[model samples]
Target: MKKILIIGIVASGKTTFAKRLSQKFSLPWYELDSIVHHNTATGRYKRSAEEQFEIIKEIDIKGAWIFEGTDRDSYQCLYQMADTIIFLDTPLWKRKVRILTRFIKQKLGIEKCHYKPDIMMLKMMYKWTRDFEQSRNSFDAKLNRYNEKVIRLRDSNNLDVTKGTRLS
Candidate 1:
């Protein structure tokens, strides 16, 4: 209802869905990648974990906003700041399709990372999604402590999120 944080694997639609949520709530949309990639180039500039967290703290200090991304402890730097936390846990194959599509799109010049997203970057994201251990991702820890406020979406098609609640 207030601050919302989105966590998801690569190509899980976090950015797109976050935009929708922003419109639905009439709140400003904050794409972590966008800010993290700002002033750099497409897909090339990535902020360090420390800098990322700093931004989150800055956002929280400024008050209510919708944040969308994974792997930022800065958002968690101010835990209890978010009213709802969304976890987009799509299937590995679905993610791979998305990743490849993004790659193709970027490579085709339809869109750029604002920097660069080479094969290695894609591989890392793919690996993270395919083999990401829930226990390993910081989101898992935040989730465990805030399960009541968490919404888990297991499918890429969003079969589990409904009526403003998590179905499963």
Candidate 2:
């Protein structure tokens, strides 16, 4: 795929999948969170919706890219721009386990993260996951608009790069 968007909630393996896809396709990958909360000489700050769209546009001009992140209203335009949209629909129980495991790893310094791996952040991760499920209908409806280009994966491990994403 030329332009890809890997979308999912917290701990859904979007980042991992995007990395693999990018490597296989020899494309650049971006974490959308980095765009939303931009780092500067001063500190990290949230960009406005307009600014976020502009950044995405700039990246679009550079050619193929794979962007991974939870769905956000600010960057909804990416859906229309992408050649492929991968939705990681990992199981709820597995995601819950991953959230805890990730927190433990981050807290123990085994895993590096952009933000502090505090209890609050862990709680927020779970909260976001729950919120995502509650609003899945809305998300699915949005996804339907791009049904021709969408691929849903229950687990990233099951994907076979050699066979391509369409293979079961």
Winning model by TM-score: 2
Lowest lDDT 10-residue stretch of candidate 1: 159-168
Q: Kindly list the per-residue Cα lDDT of model 1 for residues 1-168, writing each as its tens digit.
A: 688877776788888888777777787768877666656334356677677777778877876788888755444553477887788876667778889899889988997665467898888877777566544565566577877777877653543355344522
Q: Candidate 2's residue-wise lDDT over 1-168, tens digit each?
A: 899999999999988888887888899999999999988989889999999999999999999999999999999999999988888888999999999999999989999987889989999999999999999998988888888888888887655633334422
Query: For candidate 1, what is the TM-score?
Result: 0.77
Task: Give TM per candidate.
Answer: 0.77, 0.93
TM-score for candidate 2, residues paired by index: 0.93
Candidate 2: residue 128 Cα off by (Å)? 0.7
Q: Which stretches of candidate 1 lie over 4 Å from their true place?
A: 35-51, 133-142, 155-168
Predicted candidate 1, C-alpha RMSD: 3.6
* Native-to-model Cα distance after best TM-score fit, residue 66 in candidate 2, in Å: 0.4
Shift in Å, residue 111, candidate 1? 2.4
